[model samples]
Target chain A: MEVLFTFLPKTAHQEKLEKEFPDVDFHFTYKEKSRLPSVDILVTYGEDITEEDISKAEKLKWIMVASAGVEKMPLQAMKERGIAVSNVKGIHKTPMAESVLAHLLALKRSLPFIYESQQNNQWNRKTGSSELFGSTALILGPGAIGSEIGRLLQAFGVRTIGCNRSGSAADYMDEMTSFEDILMKLPEADLIISVVPSTKETKHMLKKEHFEAMKKDAIFMNFGRGDLVEDQILLEALENGAVGYAVLDVFEQEPLPPEHPYWSMKNVVISPHASSHSKKYVDRALDIFIPNLHKWLSEDLNPTNLVNLEKGY
Target chain B: MEVLFTFLPKTAHQEKLEKEFPDVDFHFTYKEKSRLPSVDILVTYGEDITEEDISKAEKLKWIMVASAGVEKMPLQAMKERGIAVSNVKGIHKTPMAESVLAHLLALKRSLPFIYESQQNNQWNRKTGSSELFGSTALILGPGAIGSEIGRLLQAFGVRTIGCNRSGSAADYMDEMTSFEDILMKLPEADLIISVVPSTKETKHMLKKEHFEAMKKDAIFMNFGRGDLVEDQILLEALENGAVGYAVLDVFEQEPLPPEHPYWSMKNVVISPHASSHSKKYVDRALDIFIPNLHKWLSEDLNPTNLVNLEKGY
Candidate 1:
């Protein structure tokens, strides 16, 4: 099998793959698009693959995505070409969940203000703080990352509610509701975290109306796709004091423009799309790919994380 | 029964106490030390009672301190007078533990740096982050707060080691050691939190030698007493880059002087002794005090958190 890794694998990672699967031609180079010509397997991390590369790869049988979301990839073309797609799903649960808790805790503890006080050489004991215990949290996705966040929050005695498309039973939800029923839950959540994927059904899921429903002191965090939340509406809500604090790790635009008010908002934490970027990232990505590689070699090509191209997630 | 509330109880808190205990005369005043003259039951939060006040209180039988630490109070005088003392112990567990986690996670994830970048309108994704999963933490004073912090970090898969004076078993600690054996464990800790009391033996416990033994990139936090850690020694370590980050919630000299070098250190987070100040402070303190009130009235007069004068904690 001829494989091309679009993600620049670390030397150890590349060596491990090469050593484990000696029969496979593992061509791991991020810059060389020419290697895509005769590749049978391509691994990427939601990178936008060129149509030219897709057309040239007549021998391509599978595409492995090294991310939970596969929305940015050419899903339609890949589907038309009969390419089996498997993504590194559910692997971001630990890092993403940790990031959410970290940011939320920082806001409640007045940590940013405390740091500012430190900078000013002021001993500020007046800044009031609240604990995670007895707080209500609403998780918009409730999939791998959301459920894991809920579980972690539960350890702190936070009551967790989850919203899902089908209102199905979710692992760590104290209560589950349909997406349509989520707006009412907005007023109930002390914390509102949206980890919903980017799709037609979820596009602009959280706007002014949804933000308005949340408690004035509610902390909102978006570690999901930027398309799921309207930035302008969120900004207005923040300005109007309808939302207390917003930790935006994902934005409508990458490397959010300098003109954006979010950068200047004292109540907002602009995390530069690195919430899931951990030192152990390469190892986590491999946990998904290596296991599936074994299954693929045995002709059981349908991996556990096989993506449904029509769903666009 | 006569009572003097020196902590300035909120009207609501005063009303609740008065409503619950009709027989007790609640002398609620933060100022006017004249109120202490006829007090039989004194309610305070580690405020020192002068020799004059002690001599004036002819009927003073019990002092209810609304904090875990009673070091500032006249312990020797109270002991000599055969006056009973009670403190609200273990009430700070939740808030203190949460504060420790908040600061540690912020350092590991570069939340402070990210907030700085947001202020500068810079999109910097290169500020690397380390995950808590594979890290190890060493907690000093493995009492209620220490154990609670250990349990919470366990959910994040952090290996927790605890140090206690007696080398006694503590909950949620993967390993427990004595104060003497702590030096060896210093180099292994990614995070070191000190919650040890400000006792004679514990004063300057974490000095230059301890800081030198710690991992170069280790994050150190002092949420215990200021006296337990030597400020000058810590400043030297921070300057020398021996300590990666220092979250000092307590200082030897509070309102830590404007000219203090800690104010100028980028690697330090001057926490201003507010780590345990939560909005729910009144309610949590009452959790310990109210029950003791009932016990005192029944003539049993035995409080769960009665302080041993010699220990000074």
Candidate 2:
């Protein structure tokens, strides 16, 4: 089998794949090349792939996305080309969930303020420190990542309210609410976390009305796509005290633009979309991919986390 | 039936006490007045009491310390006077445990660096983000607070090792080790949390040898007592890269001197002895005190969390 990887794997991973799968012809490159026409399988982070590349790749049968967010991929082109796509979905559950808790706890414990105070040798004790225990959290899109976050939050005695499109019950959630009914549950949530995927229905899901329904001191975090809510609306909500604080990991624009108002906002925490960036990221993704490769070589081809290109999950 | 409170209670708490215990005479004061001799019971935060106060309180039979630490209170004088003492020991479990997690997550997530980058309009993706998952944590003094911390860490898949006077098993801990065996376990801990009480046995518990035994990147947190390790030794550990980071919530000196090097060190996170400070602190402490008060009022006199005067727990 001829395979192409657009992203570089770690040296150990490279060694493992080359050593273990000696029958497969592997090519790794970032430069534009003619290898696309002959590639049978392509692995990527879903960011660099384009519709042009998809059109030229006549031999490509499968696209293995190493990252969870496959929104950037040319889903329509791949669908037309009959390319089967799979992502490392559950691999992010640990790192992403840990990131969510990190932001939540840091904001609640006033670590930013404490860090600032330390620079000035200030011993101010009035940090407005609060407990995660007994607080209510509304988690949008309670999939693997959200469920993991809910489980961790519950360990601290937090009430987890899971919100999804189907209003289906999920693990570790105290209650379930559909996306349409999120506003009704908004007022009760001390924290509102967005982990919903990027899709037609989910785009601009959180409008001004949703922010208005939230408590004045409610902490809002967006670990999902940034287009879930308009930046201006979130800014207005924060400025007017409709929402107390925001921990933003993803943004509508990459690098967030130097002149963005969020950079200057005291209540805003910008993470440069690095929530899922871990040393073990590539290793975990390959763990899922390597097993699927074995299944494909055996002619089963029943890969886990096969993405429905139309639904865009 | 006369009761004296050294600290002021919330209006709701005062109203509840006044309305419920109508026959009991309650006096709230911070002034050094002559109400000590007539008091049958005293309520304090264990900080303001002294040997002179104990000797002056001829009619005082019991001391209700509204805090976990009784190290500040004249335990010797109270024992000599045959005065009974009780403290709200378990009330700190929730907030303190949450604080420990807050510091851990904040450091692991590089919030301090993120905040700095935000201030400079730098969109840096290399945050060195790490997960609590698969990490090992050694918790010193796995009592109520440590057990609570262990439970929360366990949810994140962290291996929790509990250390106390006895090597007895504790809730939420994967394994149990005595303090004597801490050096052996130190190398395996990614995080070492101190929640031990301030006592002769625990004084200077983490010394130069202990720091040398830890992993190069091990994170040390002191939530137990400031005097558990000297400032000089900890500073040396951080300077020499023997320890990666230190989150100090307690210090040997209050309002840690302006000239202290810890304030300027990037690897050090300083919290002004405020980890236990919570909005619900008094309410939770009173929850334990009020139920115990019923026993005292009914001539039972026995209280929950009665301190062993000699051990100073």
Candidate 3:
């Protein structure tokens, strides 16, 4: 069988893959040229993969996404072509969760202001410094990534509230609330972090009214899909002091155009969607992918993170 | 009985004190001009209290320090006069520990750089973003504040090494080592945090050799006493990359002079000694002080955090 990687892996990883599957034809490139039609398996980050690429790959039976988010991929086209898709889902929990805490602690401790003060060689102690202890956090989605974030936050004595579709109890969360009932819980949360996946139903989940329901000084963070809230609604909330601050790792548009108001907003922390970028990321992804590859090769069982095309996770 | 408060308590706290001790006179002022001679108990932050002030207070039986640090207090005079001393020691753990995490996370996530990038409206994703997981942190003086910091860091999957006088096992630490043996563990620590008290034995604990023994990329933090490490030694380490970064909340001099080299260094983050400054500081300090006051008034018992005059904690 032929395996094609649309993104360049580390030289050591390429060598390891070649050694592990000596019988398989392995092709690695950002631009996988003539072998596209003959590719039996495709591994990608799901960013550069398009509907046209799916149509050209006649021999492709399965698409393995190295990253958790599959929203950027052509799900409909893949579904129509009867292509099986599996993604490394829980791999981002560690780095992404750390990123959440990094932003939360930085903002809460007034590090941004402190750093700015350092630039002017000023030793200003009136930083409006605060602690995370006894504060309430509302984590939307509360899946693998959110639960990890909750676990870390709870360690610092933060009361974590996880929100999901059914309001099922999640590990490390003090309370659980349904997505439908979030409005009732908004005012009590000092922090609100969204880690929900992208989908039609999940799109624009937080609107202007949701921000209005929150406490005036509440910090809103979108580490999930950018479409979770309309950019304009969040901007208005921050601009009006309805939401005190925003720690954004995702945007409605990738690279978040230079003209975007968020870049200039003092209350907004832009992370350039780099929260999930870790040196160990590829290794962790392969830990899931390689084992799944073995299971797929030896048996007919589906891989662990097999995505449902209609749900689009 | 007369009690002198050199620091202002909250209006509500003042009312509470007056209501609780109606028979006792409560004097509040920065300059307790005429009351010093009549004062039975002095409640101060210990900064302005001098040996002369202690000598003037002929009626002073106990000094109720409202802060953790007693290094600046007139301990020699208080001890000579047979006056007892107590401070709100453990009250700083929550805010101080949270501050440690804030600085560590900020540096690890390249937040200072990210904030600078935001100023230029640059969407820079090449931030050397890292996670705190599976790293080693050497906590010097794992007492109340250090242990709390260790507990929080442990929850993030960091292996904590607590160093103290005896090197005895500490809560939340994976390993323990004596203050003398820290040089051996320095190379293994990705983060070194000093929370040791200021004493003759503790002063200049981290000198040129200690910094030389540390990992080249290790981050050093001084949240303890400014005298724990000589400023010149730390400056040399940072200048030579012997220490990768320094997060300082304490310095040899208060309001670290504008001419200080650390202020200009890109790798150093100066916090203006505000890590322990919390909105709830006075409340937490009062929580310890009020109960102690009741015990002292009803029964001639020593307060919970009664300091050993000779040991200077």
lDDT value for candidate 1?
Answer: 0.86
Per-model DockQ against the true two-chain complex:
0.79, 0.80, 0.80
* Clash totals for all candidate models: 0, 0, 0
State the lDDT of candidate 1 residue by residue for A1-313, as single tens digits. Answer: 8989876888998999998999999988765768777888888876758666788889989888888787777777889998898887887888788888889888878888898887777787897888888999999989989999999999999999999999999998999988999887888999999898899988998778898899999998889988887778888999999989888999999879989988787788899988887888889888888888899899987877889999876
Per-residue lDDT tens digits for candidate 2, residues B1-313, read 9999998887898888888789999888774437998999999887889899888999999999888898888888899998999999898888888889988887777777788899999999999888778899999999999999999898878999999988899999999999888889999999999988899989888899999999999999999999899889999999999999999999988889999999988888899998988888888987887888889999898898989998887
Candidate 3 CAPRI classification by DockQ: high
Model 1 agreement with the true structure over B185-274: per-residue lDDT tens digits: 999999998898888889987778999999999988888999887777888898898888888888898778888888887888888888
TM-score of 1: 0.97
TM-score of each: 0.97, 0.98, 0.98
**CA-lDDT, candidates in order:** 0.86, 0.89, 0.89
Task: Compose the digit string of candidate 3's lDDT tens values, residues B1-313.
Answer: 8899998887898998899888879988875556799999989988889888877889899888888889888788889898989999898899899889988887777777788888999999998777788889999989999999999998989999999999999998999999889899999999999998899889988889999989898999999989998888999999998989899999999989999998888888898999998889888888888888898898766888999999998
Worst 10 residues of 3 chain A by lDDT: A27-36
Q: How well does candidate 1 score on lDDT at residue A132?
A: 88
- Compose the digit string of candidate 3's lDDT tens values, residues A3-57: 9998999999999888887887889998665678999889998888888888899
Off by over 4 Å in 1: none
lDDT of 2 by residue, A1-313 (tens): 9889987777788889999899999887765447999998889888888999998898888889988888988888999878899999998888888888988887777777788888878999998887888999999999999999999999888999999998999999999999989889999999999988999989988999999999998999999999999888999999999999999998888879998999999889999998888888988988898989988888876688999989998
